[model samples]
Target chain A: MPRLINRHPGRGPALMLGLVPFIVLIFAYLLGSHVRLAANPDDKLLPTPSTLMSTLHTYAAEEDVRSGQVLFWVDTMASLERILIALVLSASIGLAFGLAIGALPVVRAALAPFVAVVSMIPPLAILPILFIVLGLGEVAKIALMTLGIAPVIVRDLALRAAELPSEQLIKAQTLGASSWQLVTRVILPQMWPRLIDSLRLSMGCAWLFLIAAEAIASTEGLGYRIFLVRRYLAMDVILPYVAWITLLAFLMDWALKILRSRAFPWTDMSR
Target chain B: MARVTVKGLWKRYGDTVVLENINLDFADHEFVTIVGASGCGKTTFLRILLGMEQPSKGRLLIDGEPVSPEPGPDRGIVFQRYSLFPHLTVLGNLILGLELRRSRVLGKLFGARRREAIVRAESILEAVGLAGARDRYPAQLSGGMQQRLSIAQSVIGEPRILLLDEPFGALDPGITADMHKLILDLWAANAMTIFMVTHDLKEGFELGTRLLVFDKLRHDPQAPEAYGAKVTYDIPLRRLKNDRERQRLAIVEASGSEPSYAPAG
Candidate 1:
């Protein structure tokens, strides 16, 4: 009897295999776009690749008439800056909170339930409150992203810290580590890679909150530009912008993974 | 070197008692081994001695002064598992205590002192036969190597007393033999006062200058918590030089509910 052995593909084959689905989707889109355009050259719904490229060039390569700014670069920079700031703020808060709660029984008993409750409340529901307090500026947008992602990072880190062997804590204590020293030397040193992992896991949710906040109110951002183009049925600009945002997100995720593997190779169980 | 004295020690968790009326004196530079049946409060006793857990009633004294309620450099401990910090390499684990002692900030050992610590750590690693694995993480080492590194880590602190809670309980015979020799060498070389708990009776007899056996003699099913484990025997092995004495002690252990030691010949 013939049997099928579905072994995991190597890097080259895996990459080629990954592109198969995308190639199929593109081929289908191209055929459909061609048919629609053949019927009506004035169709604005499914813009051809050339139309999208030209629109992308105008936004990315050329300067705007009024502001003299490359809108694509400006939007990318604004969105990236907001995300970077939010991620840093949230990760720092999460790591500190998680370390305290996980290491200290009093802190855990006092704040664990409160943190759990806060995490349950969706961040988007409080978007209006954030705007009212912080105004409809970059602060509000970044705050929304931070609020959405920080709690999750906290939960993950706390759980990880709690799961560490009690022996490690005892060993550190026996070595004359004070409570502060124990947390800083033993707990925090071990937690750096896990913190990075928690941040990486929260990145997807961060992007979602970032886009939502920017879409609601922002002068210059990828999300704001996407919403702006949607008003005039500018699918050419909208699709490319969406693609560009996806690319940026994937790159960020890939870079973090590489950093984690390179810097804390011991954390990788597979190795 | 410091003498350890335990007077009227008792430990309880809620309604259930674990250790009851433990009183003993450990001389400086003595190698003491505690052996007992499973769930006989050996580990609980060791934990109390290490200051990781407090006794319900009684106090431990190091030399003439009372031991601190919390763990400190005066006493060090090695557990059967998870003794090494997984994040640190073999050399890093050995130097951690030195680094922490010198630096105010954690994980930031600096300048000439740091280099000195590393050099000392490397020598300790070589002594422990782990020089080749100095750069590897604990997870990268074999179980035997990991235990050796952990022993080095505890010894690096130069603690007056070293507590072991069945540190060789999980290793195979060959590795366990190597560990026993290594531990004995370290103890003699450093002049450390050592206290260890183990389930293996032969191991208890082989390595200990003094052996303490723990057991529960009374069992009341209706009042299960009525009796807790107590030190049944405090035999000084240094004086048991003849087969007659060993046979006498073994016979006494078999016949009586409490451990009895034979008089020194």
Candidate 2:
């Protein structure tokens, strides 16, 4: 008699039940678009300023839709490549220094106030300077994402390292564990279950920040496509791209969840 | 094998004395339980024995040599609350000491550390009746099983001396008794020295080889300037081999309750 989650008793129906809200959201959002169109036919359904202003249905059938789709696929690949590069760089930076700072209490205390001060300024505030310094190239995007994500990653890890049980750590020391071994055995293994959750959350934030950064400066990413679509008021073109990006972000989260479950299968999902 | 001897042990946190002139000895393979009411300095005494702290006026000797105020391979501690790592599997939790503490770089690279660690952990877990539950996480285990897992970890490290602070105090009576039996079985098998702090009277009687009830009010001359705790009694478990011992064990059991204190002279 599970009460909170399983309203349905069995698998087949339960799986179907999971899909109901998503199905309903699509139906509802699309229905609202129709109603909005019916109420104001003269009002633009979507933005398509690049080619020409047109109705939602009219632009839905144009080359803009096809062109947008092509742009989407290419830019998605580029964005993905950028994110992977950023992940490696940030993970390296985050882990190397994170472990160092996280492990040492003196280092953490000395740097904590400064770290907190810098975090509040918002990484997005210095985009123009980053653009000037690194140029509006893939390097800047990758660098920005690393800078943006690493601190958060390190901060999370540092706090976790701090939260590590004092007794076990004392026990490890009593057993003659080296510092490296402490990190490898006690820290990382324990860090993983949390690190996975942070990684998943960081993935979403990375996407959001990357898309924003790309939109402001990128000529060829999904953000550029969204910006390009906005010119001609093509709602249908813009809408699907939004839907795809949303769906992809969701999929990445779900996929990462699967990876987490596979990697550390022992942890029960924390609701 | 070290004969851990503490002499005129003095410890204090600021102005409050925790253990004063606490003289005690744990021979190789001796299982001594330090039982007292809470804040009775039993744990502080254990920590001092483990070398996590130094006695202000006393000396701690391992094999009759002074030990550093730091943890070493000779000591293994099992805390009641923080028994196992929440993220690691039972096997992973068990081998952490060996993998991280014993193995060298070559050991890690040759993959010997991992292999040997796993082997040791598996055998340890099996000894504690946790073979079927190797893949289970600490969070997935019941309190009793987790306690067993913790015991395996401490015991598997094969330290010269084991320090446990209220290891079964958190469990229900049924689980606690089961854990006590498991601990007894492990002790019987290994015959290594064990020093545990406990407040459970029945548990102290059930698990201890030698019972030392800390006298929180006993005056110590050397430690008067530092910490000021005293001992009530140190009873040999051999005396409690039968039901008659249980009757004599009344004083050992009663020490856990509030007793009127004489002002230190």
Candidate 3:
């Protein structure tokens, strides 16, 4: 038999092992829910799977009497729109600021310290300020998410750009590359995968900011729905909504990973 | 082809002097190899010639005109590593120089011009023995193949002068022999004046028509930065051809008693 340290599972066995924790957690939750429902038939803290499924069916299939639209789909769409817009805005701001600050010494001198300080400020602390300045609208929510993550992306990409080997830049210059050409031809191509990676990392923060802003002010969103239903002890609705959000986040992260590998195959070998 | 002339060149970073009072002249199509100890400013000299660096005092002239402070396509360089852009395939790396030279804004070409660039790139890739790997990224290549692509990337522009900074220092000894042959063939075919800085004295002597040795003449124990290196021995090896014993003696004498040549930075 192999020693414990040396013993390693094959790919098939390793994937099987990865599912063990999820299976155990689900089994434990089902047992707890059964016990709770047996003790109190009207218990709402841990709803049985049937109750949860029925609630999901009602929210997803039935339109609200007044809204004339399905609340579940409406909430998901509103949340997706806000997060996607915020992500695009943050990525553009990050890429443009990061490359300028990293590639040009003058830009670094002028803005690096300011960016450093900005990144240090707690983004959530200024929620009220943002709401007041940008008003209680979609702009405020998007601004909150963008402000939360753009500085981090800028700092990460700046470090990456600055860490690029000086030899490559010199070689580009010797090939008749001007300043703009150097950035566009040499530095910019290498930063795309890294930018994707930064976006992947910032996804969680973006969702947090999105939910916080929506919980505070929005009329419709996944976060708003969850928060609105919390007063009634609606575990049946909240639990499924939380799971759905997690699945959506997982799919997004997985998509980005696939995009990175397919678009920038060279980065895999670099690691 | 380019004639390079250096007159009283000095490079000092504040209080620390890196190179002091260097003077040399090179005719067109000459292959000069520079060997020195670590931190002796051989790479700095090459950078100056390539116009990536400017001398603190004195002038570097090419064909009787002062070389521009900014690096230009007139000169090409291949470092030991990180010379090829990793994001680009081998052919993409070769075509980039031409595209950058031709199209200033987009740094890209189209139609017939793009086809012409590809043809030029393919031919150079063929010359460098990388025709099979033209579609592969630099990271996918072996060390020796990457170095070949680097050399190809530099030479594709057909610059008048080629600067090599220890281009083979990272390769295996067995692989370096093949590289030496490739570089010699490229040098002869391109007819560009070349200045190569190498840590290996034997490789320098074997490759260069002219050999330069950079060493410091004076040193102060209290202040190590008080002095800088100069070209101590400038030997024309073409005259010493067919004399193996003389070449061996010259290598021994140039290295001196300690011969502790560190890798060039």
Candidate 4:
């Protein structure tokens, strides 16, 4: 008898309800594939589910005749290595620059405007310039990812440090904290959780930059593999590759989120 | 112990004057309570005493010497809120002062030194009745518990002077009485001069050995920034118990007829 808006489901029903859309989409895909396959057996636009699964298995398990390495994992490792290096580099640089810009007036006056200007420049537009200068090597790909996200992380952390309650700074000073001590003892520790949060938010952008760079120049990577097979209209290979990339991105984000909550429990007070 | 002396003190921010031509002397261990209307300079004056702000004119002397320009361990402060670090546990907050003082670069102690600091921190936590909550974060604690921790954080440093700016203003009325008792006990136990600013006049009368009232004795209707608040009433409460009622009545009358008291000059 309750109004639809007021009828809130319990946990089990809510979870089941959340899956309804995914279920509908999958059923629709299967129906479309069957219809397309019944008309023509050589249809490549919508591969049958069985064909898609076999293609995924081949790519994942079979060894390539030329490279002798499992192509899927080799591509995955190549992509992961580039993205992780860029992420680590971005995090460290962001923390240092952010704290410096936020805590000290001199540093802020000098660098805040510069950082703002840098962040405003669309990172993708500079990919050609990066490629020319750093060359079509691993450095260019890593640089692209770092450049795309580091400014954002720096700007976010700088604002966080700047908005720290003035009272806390004064209290720390009264406790005999020097200028350096203020940064390390008070400001630096609080930046860890926020840094992790910034990294989580930056993951998608990092992946985009990685893919774009790899598609343009790399010989071996997830993005390279997808583009390499696209000329033949290989939907089966491309579809599985896209799904694998999504799964990998989801897993990395999930791992970082779990690490943040576990290591910095105080940051999430709602729990 | 520290004896503080103020002479011809003035504070101004550009055209607006906050406090003007104030002077006073506080002996060691005196509990001075300051009361005034909003926008008055009680807080500014306290900041000057804490070395967080500089006087526009004249001097502030502690023990017959000019006070340090920068805040040091000699002075401790507790604001109304945001005084405790959110990232630190209750016990971590207590030993932070000692750690900063002893280990200049790292801001941390190690081995035997670390154990000693923890023991000291535990004793202070026990004193503040936060022993059970030593591992808890500030957000998890109630308002009263947080304020208690703030006070404990300030007192553990063994400062010569303690400045509190409306520390209990955000606490519930039921919890204030307990806070008052805790502060009074701390004041008695530590040989430190105390200055507290409060909006509640009766609280000023109850807790202080001396009461100071800051009110502007001059005003300009056209240019309101022409004048600033001064210490108009300095009542010695402890020595003159018989005169309490009379002084209270005088403050009420003065505040009631504030316009008459503020001359055009």
The best candidate by DockQ is 3
When sorted by lDDT, best at the front, the candidate numbers are 3, 4, 1, 2
Least well predicted 10-residue stretch by lDDT in candidate 3 chain B: B256-265
Q: What is the interface RMSD of each candidate, in Å?
A: 7.0, 7.5, 3.4, 7.1
Best of the two (1, 2) by DockQ: 1
| Per-residue lDDT of model 3, residues B1-265, tens digit only | 5999999999999999999999999999998999999899999999888887789999999999999888888999999898889899888898999999999999999999999999989988888888888788787788888888889888988999999999999987766766876888899899799999999999999889999999998999999999999999999987765485355547555644422122221
The candidate, 1 or 3, that scores higher on TM-score is 3
If scored against the real structure, what TM-score would every candidate get? 0.90, 0.81, 0.94, 0.93
Report the number of the highest-lDDT candidate.
3
Better of 1 and 4 by lDDT: 4
Per-residue lDDT of model 2, residues A1-271, tens digit only: 5786666548988789899998998687667666776788665673233323233335344334645544545777887888888877777766766676788777888876776676565778877778999998988888778778888877877787888878877877766676666777667776776766777778877887788888888877766667776887756566666766788788878987898888876566321
The docking category that best describes candidate 1 is acceptable
Error of 2 at A61 (Å): 12
Model 2, range B116-232, lDDT digits (tens) per residue? Answer: 678767877776778888886777676677778877887777788888889887876645545655676777688578898998876676677788888666556756535455778
* lDDT at position B239, candidate 3: 72
Q: What local distance difference test score does each model get?
A: 0.87, 0.73, 0.91, 0.90
Q: Model 3 chain B, TM?
A: 0.90
Model 4 chain B weakest 10-residue run by lDDT: B256-265
Residue-level lDDT tens digits of model 3 in A102-181: 99999999999999999998889999999999999999999999999999999999999999999999999989999999
Segments in model 1 whose C-alpha atoms lie over 4 Å from true places: A1-6, A38-40, A269-271, B105-107, B240-265
The true-versus-predicted C-alpha distance at residue A210 of model 2, in Å, is 1.6
